[model samples]
Structures are given as structure tokens and as C-alpha cells.
Target: MRLLVINPNTSRGVTNRIREAADAMALPGDRFTTLCPAYGPELIVTEQDAALARQAVVDTVRGFKGPCDGIVLASFGNTGADPVRALRPSIPVVGIASAAFATARALGGPFGIVTFGKGLVPGLQAKVDEAGLSDALLGISCVAGEEFGDPGEVQTRFRSELEALCADMHQRGARSIVMGGGPLAGMARSLAPTCPIPIIDGTQAAISLIRAVAAPRGDHEPRRAAAPAET
Candidate 1:
């Protein structure tokens, strides 16, 4: 399937990280085209940032002309996913936050979220509530530290802290933990061994969910009548 993954923020570094995560999650014959809006916040951690990203995503999707079997809004909060989906109703749309929650629910237990900023917790909670998964939520943890010049380096910078947070969540009854930011895309797999429970990468969840939903539709064709049997 040909998938379009949108990083609502304009940070190329974050976009690159999202692309790497998408590539790692892809199945054979899956093609992912990842891009960022030309204008928006470098990161989406505030309501203002999300507001701008919503318009940016809408503009980006409006301007895109390439073939797309599915679309993924790569931001963990799923910034602009609804607007983009509205613009392209024919294509399947998967938001990383929603996908992550769905995967966590399917895994049959409560899940927690680990993200970059404390301010992001409310937004993440709102997403869970929106998806009707709040009842299954364990908690949300935040880790903030020295800023990295390259946002993509966030995962490495907070590796130790993230592992600790995941361990805490596990003890608190979380069966899985979600890495909850676009720049933290690939950290789940990287930190999985250190975490007692599963570390769910929103990007990977989005990719798998998109592929599953798009496959049947993309491969479907009008049925043809079988040749008449010879007497």
C-alpha cells in the first residue's frame, strides 16, 4: 500500500525520525512517504501548536497530489487527523495516538503513555477519552531535560528516564506503555528490552493499522462471473 505519513510540525529532524520509524514498521510492498508541513511549530506540545498544525496538515493534504491508499498523522496527539480525514474521505486515515490506544486495548490490558513534556499529558488524555479508551488507561508520564538541537535525538537523550518511567508504569498495573511524541517515534523498540511490559510505538501502530484497513479496499476488485461450465 502507498501510505502518506504527515508530521504536522515543520521540524525536518522530527520528520526524519518519523520516516525512520515508518520504514522500520513497513511490510513488504508497503511504501511510505513521510513529509512535514512547510509551516508550523517545531514541535506540537501546546494547544496553540496543535491549532497551527491542524491548519498546516489541512494545507499539506490539500496540496498533495500523489497517490495515497492510506494516511497517518504521525503526531502522537493526532494533531489534524480529523481535518485531513475530512478532506480525503475516500482514503483510510489512521492517527498514531488512536492506533496506539487501539493496539493497547487489543492487547487486553491497561496502558500508559510516556512523553516529552508534562504539558502534553492533558492532550494525550483527551485523545484517550475521545477514543473511549480512558477507562483502560494506566497513566501518563513526562520527561523533560536539556533540549537537543536535533529533536530526533530526544529518544536517545531520555533513554534512561524513559526506561525508569516504563518500569514505574508497569508496577502501577500498565500492561503496555506508549512512546507518546512524534520525535520519540522509534524509541519503543529501542527501549523494549529494558521495559518489563511492551513498549508500544505509535508510529508502528499507525503503520500496521493503516495497512490492515487499506489492504482489503486497495486490493478489492469487482467480481466477474465464472465461465459457464461445459455440459
Candidate 2:
């Protein structure tokens, strides 16, 4: 299957991180094309930023001409997913927030989200409510001042902060944790091993979920030729 991963933000750095995570999660025979709008905020931290990114996503997807079996909105905020899905009903759309939350629910308990800033907490909470998973959500924790530049540097700089947040979530009875933000994909991979509970990277979860939904099913078989008109 061919998947299109859209990072609504304009930051090439964040887009690259999303692409790396998608590529790592892609199954054999699956192809992923990752893109970002040429115009939008470098990072979507506020409502206005998200709004702009949403419009940009719609424009970008509408203009895209290549084959896309599925689309992954590669942002923890799930920017423009609904609009794009409405615009292209035939194509499957998966958003990182929804996918990660679903994966957390499947893991069987209350989950917490670790995001970049407090400003995003309410938005993420709203998504949990929208998914009808509010009961499964433990809470949200923020790690402020994390930069979206060089993945390696970002991961290194925020490692301690993320670890602390995860520890707090686990202490607060969270059975699983979602590391929100597409730019934080590398950090999620790095921190997962040490985390006591499952650490779901939203980008990776989005990729996996989309692929599962898009994969061909073999439950039905073709009917045999109608008995040759009664031999």
C-alpha cells in the first residue's frame, strides 16, 4: 500500500523526523511518502497555528496528484484530519492522536500523554474526549522549552525531562503513555526502553494503524463458477 504522511507544519526538521518514524514502522511492500506544507508555522503551539496548519493540509492534499491508498496526519494534535477526510472520502485517514489513543486503549488501561507544552494539553484532552476514551486517559504532562531542531540534539536535551514526566505518569497510575508531537518521534524511540509502561510514539502509531486498516483482508472467497449451469 502507498501511504501519504502529512506533517501540517512547515518545519522541515519535524517533517524529517516524521518520515524517519514512518519509514521505520512501514511493513514490507508498503511505501510511504511524507510531506509538509510549504507555508505554515514552524510548530503548531496555539489554536491559531493549528488552524493555519489545518488549512494548509487541506490545500496540500487537494493538490497532490499521486496515488495514495491511505493518509496519515502526522501530528499529535491531528490537525486537518477531519477536513481532509471529508474532502477525500475514498482515501483512509489516520491521525496520530487517535491512533496513539487507540493503541493505548488496546494496551488495556488508563494512559497519559506527554506533550511539549501546557498549551497543547487541553487540545489533546479534547481529542481524548472526541475518541470517547476520556475514561481511559490518566492525564497529560508537559515538557516545555523543547526545541524541534536536530532530532539528536532535541532527544538529548529533553531526555531527562521526558523521563521525569513518564515517571510521574506511571506514579499517577498510567498504564501506558503516549509521547505526543511528530517532532518528538526520535525521543519516543529513545525513551521507550526505559519506560516502565508502554510508550507510544504517535507518529509510529499512526503509521501502524493506517497500514493495518489499509491491508487487504482474505476473509471472503470468490464464488465458484455457478456449477456450469447444472452439469
Candidate 3:
């Protein structure tokens, strides 16, 4: 399957991070095409940044004429997902955060989020509320320091800190922890061994869910002429 992954932010580094992470999870026949907006904030940390990213995402989707079976919004907050779905109703569109939350819910317990910026906490909470999974969310934790210089380097820069946060969340009763932000896409796989609870990565979750959602089911095929209609 071909999946279109869009990063609302304009930072090429972050876009590259998303691409590498998605590529790492690609199956033999699966393909992921990742891109960033032509113009927008380098990184999204607040509602204001998201506001701009929403437009950037819409414009990028509008301009891309590639073939895809599904769309994955790489931003943790799932920026511009609604509009993209409206733009391409025939294809499946999955947001990273929505995918993460769904995975956490399916895991059967509350989940926590670990992100790079404290400023992102409110927006992430808003996303949780929007998903109607506020009850399932335990809490959100941020790395102990200012935002990083390069988003692509976050996984390496804060590996230990992120693992500690994951451990803390597990101790606090969280059954799983979501590694928030596009920059931290593939970090969970590396940290999972040490983390007491499950670590959900939004990027990986989005891809996995999209593949499932887009996969063809025999039951969904149109019935033959003699088949009876549903009551």
C-alpha cells in the first residue's frame, strides 16, 4: 500500500525524521511518501503554531498529486486531518495522535504522553479531549529543559530523559506511554525494552492503523445480483 505522510511543520529535519521512522516500519510491499509544508513554523509547540500548521497542511495536501491508498498526519496533534479527509474521502486518513490514543485504548488502560515541549501539553490535552479519550489519559510529561535546537536529534538527545519519563508514568499507573511529537517518532522501539509499560509511537501507530483500515475485506465487496439486501 502507498501511504502519504504529511508533516505540518516546514522543518526539513523533522520531515526527514518522520520519513526515516515510517520507512523503518515499512513492510516489503508497503510504501510511505513523506513531505513537509512549504511554509509554516519550524516546530509546533502551541495552539498558535498549530493554527498556522493547519493551513500549511491543507495547502500541501491540495498541491500533492501522488497516488496513495491512505494518508497519515505525522504531527502528534493530528493537525489538518479533518480537512484532508474532506479533501479525499475515498482514501483512509489517520492522525498520529488518534492512532496512538486508539492503540492505548485497545491496550485496556490509561495512557500517558511524553513530549518535547511543555508548551505542547495544553494542545495535546485538547487533542485528547477532542478524541473523547480524556478519561483514558493519565497525564503528560515534558523533557526537563528548553526545546531542542534540532527536532530530528531529539531521540538521541533525550533518550535517557524520555526513558525516565516513561518509567515514571508506568509507576504512576499508566499502562502505556505515547511518545508525542513527530521528532520522537521511532524512539519508542529503542526504549521499549527498558520501559516497564508499553511505549506507543504515534508514527508507527498511524502506519499500522492505516494499513489495517485500508486493507481490503472480502465482505465489503458488492454482492452478486441474486444476493439479498440487508434489512
Candidate 4:
């Protein structure tokens, strides 16, 4: 299945990191293409950034062609998920926050989100409420997702940061931690075992959710299929 993960931020550095991580986690047979917005903020953290990214995503949805089996916003704020869904109305549009809400509810308790910064907590919490999982939400965490770099850098930072995060979750009485955002996109296997409860990455959840949502209809005429028959 061909899935496109749209990073509405202009930062290729961040966009590349998110793409590589998504590629690594995707199931076999799942093809992912990641691209950043031509015009938008470097990274989307606040409401203003989200608005900028939203405009770009709106344009993308309008111009999208090819076989897009599923689409992911590749953002914690989920700037374009709903809009694209409303616009496209065919392909399943999955967002990190929505997927996290699903994973959170499934984990069987209030889920806490570990985002880029505490400031994002309001927006993250709002997403939880919007997903109708507010009743099952615990709260947010410490290590800001935007601070995390590549895998090696994340390992250096997360080796300690993750441990502390887990400890904090334990203190908060959270039964699960949803590592939210593309920036905090790190290996889930290593953290899952040690965490007090379940450790879920919104990136992985969003990817898998997009995969499970079912591929788009092949009826949308592909260039090859649309070619006139040669008599």
C-alpha cells in the first residue's frame, strides 16, 4: 500500500527524521512517502504554526494524485487530518493525536502523553478530549519532543530522559505513556519493556493505524489505467 506522510513544516531536517523513522516502523508491503510543505513554519509547536501547516496541507489535499492508499499528518498537533478527511472523503486520513487516543483507550487506563514541551500539553489534552478519550487521559510528560534529534542523539538523551519519563509517569499514576509527536520518534521496543505501563509512540501508532484503515479505492484512475487502448 502506498501511504503518504505529510510534514507540514519546512524543516527538511525534521521532516527527514520523521520519514526515516516512519519507514523503519512500517510493516512489510507498506510503502511510505514523506514530504514537507513548500511554505510553512520550520516546525509546528504552537497554534500559529499549526495554522500555517494547515494551509499547506489544504493545498496538498487539493492537488493530491497518484495512489494514496492512506495518509498521515506526521504531526502531533494533527494540523490537517480532519480537513483532509473532509476534503478527500475517500482515503483514510490518520493523525498522530487521533491514533494516540485510540492506543491510549486500548491500553486500558488513562494515557499520558510525552510531548516536545509542557506547553503543548494544552493542545495534546484538547486532542484527547476531541477523540472522546478525555475520560481515559492522565496527562503530559517532561522531555520535549522537539529537542530529540536522530536515533543516536535520541539514544544519548533518551537513555536517561526516557527512564526519568517512566518514573514520572509512575508517579502520576499513569498506566500508559503515549510518546507523542514526530520529533520524539524513537524505538518503541526498548522503552516499552521498562516503562511502568505501556509505552506507545504516536508515530508508530499513526503508521499502523493508517495501514489498518484499509487502502484507498483503486477506482481513482491511475495514469496507467487511464491510458487509451491502442487499437
Candidate 5:
């Protein structure tokens, strides 16, 4: 299988990190390709960035060409997802947040998302609500104390802040935690130890669901072949 993962954010550093983590989940027969938007905010830290991510998703699908069997939007907020669907209705475009949330629900629990930016928390709530899994979610929460666009310090600061947020959520009622972004994929497992509950990273959830949706499955195959009539 060949999966195309799109990081709607403009940060190549984050894209590179996502590419590495997502690829590791691929089975031996599968291949994964990752990309970042050439034109968009470096971080989807605001509603404006979400709007731009919608445009970026459209542009990406219009320009993509490869043996792509599945499409994964690399942002946790499901940025650009609905617009992309409007542009390319038939394509199987999966939002990372939606996918992760679905997986967490399937795993069965009160799930919580720990994301960056104060501005993005409401939007994340909207995303989860839109997915119709708000009932399954304990809540969508944010980790404060940093601006996502500060690329020079974003990575390290994001890690530390995410750690604290996950801990707090665990203290609250989050039975399952989604680390909540492509860039933070590598830290999901590490946080799980400190967390009293399981951690569901976007990469793991995305990859697992993508595989499930792609793989052929059924209780039984069709036993009858189509009949050809002689004219």
C-alpha cells in the first residue's frame, strides 16, 4: 500500500518528523510518502491557519500524483478536511484528528486530546464534536505557555508543555490521551508511562485505522459468479 500523508502546516521540520514516525508503522508490504504545504502558516495555531489549511488541502489533492491508495491529513485539528472533500469528493481523505478519535473510541474509553495553543482548543472541540464522538471524549484540552509559530523553540517547548498537559488530563478523567499532533508522535509512548491511562498518538491511530480501512475483510466471499447471456 502507498499512503500519502499531508502536513497542512508549513513547517518542514515537523513534516520530516511525521514522515519518520508514520513510516515506521507501515508493514513490510506498505510504503508511505509524506509532504508539507509550500504555502501556509508554519503552525496551525489559530483559526486563520485552519482556514488556510483548507486551501492547502485543495491544492495538495489537485497537485498530487502517485500510487496513492489512501490520504491522511497530517494535522490533529482536521484542518482542510471538509474543503478537501468538497474539492475531491471521491477520494478517501482521512483527517488525523478524526481518525485518532475514532480509534480511541474503538479502543473504548473516555478519550481526551492534549493539543497546543489556547486559540486551537475551541477548534479542536469543534472537530471532535463534528466527528460525532464528543460523547466518547472526556474533553479536548490545550497546553498553554507557548506560541506555535515560534519555530526556533516550538519543538522542545511543545514536548514539555504536552507532557504537563497529558499529566493534568490524566488527573482529571481522561482514560485515554491523544498526544494530538504529527510532530509529537514520537513522544506518545513515553508519556503513556507517566499517564495513568493509555496514550493514543495521532500517528499510531492514523496508521492503524488506515490499515484497517484498506485491508480486505469479510465473513465470507461471494460464492456465485456473474452470468453472461448469449445474444
Candidate 6:
């Protein structure tokens, strides 16, 4: 199966990180093509930043001429996902935020989100409400520091900060946690082992959803057939 992954932000580092994480989860025959728009915010933290990134996402999808079984919007906020879906109704378009929320719900949560930038909390919270998962949401936490700094440094700092937040959420009745943001995908994978509860990475969650969507139905599954017309 083929998948098109779009990073709404212009940061190549984040885009590359997303690609690497997705590659690790890809099946032998599966192919993933990841790209970022030529222009957009390097990192989206504020509402204004997200607004610009959303436009870039829309433009990128509008200009893309590649063939793929599905598309993955590799951003926790799911910028431009609604427009993308509306523009391409025949294609499957999965967003990281929705994918992570779905996974968290399946795990029977009260799940919390741990991400960068305190400024993004409101947007993240809004997304939770939009998903109709407000009842299942525990809370949202942010790690201090620049969100688009060196990947290794960011991950190291995030791990320490996130661990504390996760523990706090656990005490607050959170059953699981979602490490939001596509750039933090690697960090999520690394931190999951040490976390007290399940940590759902947005990228990984999206990948899992994409695989399920691309997979063939079981032989016993019923197929929809056309009705016969009387002559």
C-alpha cells in the first residue's frame, strides 16, 4: 500500500523525523511518501502560526499529483484536515490528532496529552472537544523550551519534563497519555517504555489506522453486491 504523509509545517527536521518514525512501522511492501510545503511556519505554536500552516497544507494537497492509497496529516492539531477531506472525498485522509484520540478511546481512557508549547494547549483542548472526547480527556500538559530546536536535545528535555507530567496525570485518573505533535514521534517511542501508562504517539497511531484501512477484509466478511434488475 502507498501512503502520502504531509507535514503542515515547513520544518524539514520535523518532516524527516515523521518519515523515520513512519518507516519503522511500515510493512515490507508498504511505501510512504512524506513531504512538507515549500513555505510555512517552521513550528506551529500559536493560533496565527496554525492558520498559516493550514493554508500551506491545503495548497500542498491541492498541488500534489502523486498516487497513494491514503493520506496522513502529520500534525497533532490536524491543520487543514477538514478542507483536505472535503477536496478529496474518494481518498482516505487521516489526521494525527483524531488517530491518537481514537487509539486513546480504544484503550478505555481518560487520557491526557503531553506536548510542547503552553500556548498550544487551548488549540489541543479544542481539538479534543471537536473529537467529542472531552468526557474521556484527563488533561493537556506542555513541556517547556523551544519546540523546534535540535531533535536530540528536544527529546532529552521533553522526556524528563513529560515523565513528571505523566505521573501527575496518572494520579489525576488518566488511564493513558498521548504524546502530541509529529516532530515528537521519536520521543514518544522512546518515552513509552518508561511511562507508567500507555503513551500513544500521534504518528504511530495514524500509521496503525492507515494500515487497518489499507488491509484487505477477511474472506468470511460479507461483500456488498449490486442488486439485480428485473427485465
Model 4 accuracy (lDDT, Cα): 0.70
Models ranked on lDDT? 3, 1, 2, 6, 5, 4
TM for every model, in the order presented, reads: 0.88, 0.85, 0.89, 0.80, 0.80, 0.85
On TM-score, the leading prediction is: 3
- Model 1, span 6-111: residue lDDT tens: 8888888788888888888765555568889989898887888889989999998898876678888989778887788789999888889888888898997888
**Deviation in Å, model 6, residue 188 alpha carbon:** 2.2
Q: Specify the highest-lDDT model's number.
A: 3
- Give me the runs in candidate 4 sitting further than 4 Å from their true place: 144-159, 216-231
- lDDT of each residue in 1-231, candidate 6, tens digit only: 667788888877778777777777776556677888878787777888888988899888888775567788988788888899898777678999989999998999589988776766887889899999999987888877544365324556566777787778778888999887776876677776677788888877887897787653234424332112110
- Per-residue lDDT of model 5, residues 1-231, tens digit only: 566778888777787767766766766556577877779888776778778877876797778765556678878777777777776565467888877787777778688888766766776787778878878878767766545765424547777777888888888877788766666755676676777788887765776776766643232434332122100
Error of 1 at 219 (Å): 11
User: Residue 28 of model 2: what lDDT?
Assistant: 54
In angstroms, the error of model 6 at 224 is 31
Lowest summed lDDT across 10 adjacent residues in model 3 is found at 222-231
* Model 6 vs. true fold: TM: 0.85
Q: What is candidate 3's lDDT per residue for 40-131, written digit by digit as tens?
A: 89898877888999998999889877567888999977899888999989988988999998898899788999988777788889988988
Query: What is candidate 6's CA lDDT for residue 99?
Result: 93
Q: Report lDDT (CA) for all predictions.
A: 0.81, 0.78, 0.83, 0.70, 0.71, 0.77
Question: Which portions of model 5 miss their true places by more than 4 Å?
Answer: 83-91, 146-155, 215-231
Candidate 3 — which residues are off by over 4 angstroms? 215-231
Clashes of each: 0, 0, 0, 3, 0, 0
User: Candidate 3 or 5, higher lDDT?
Assistant: 3
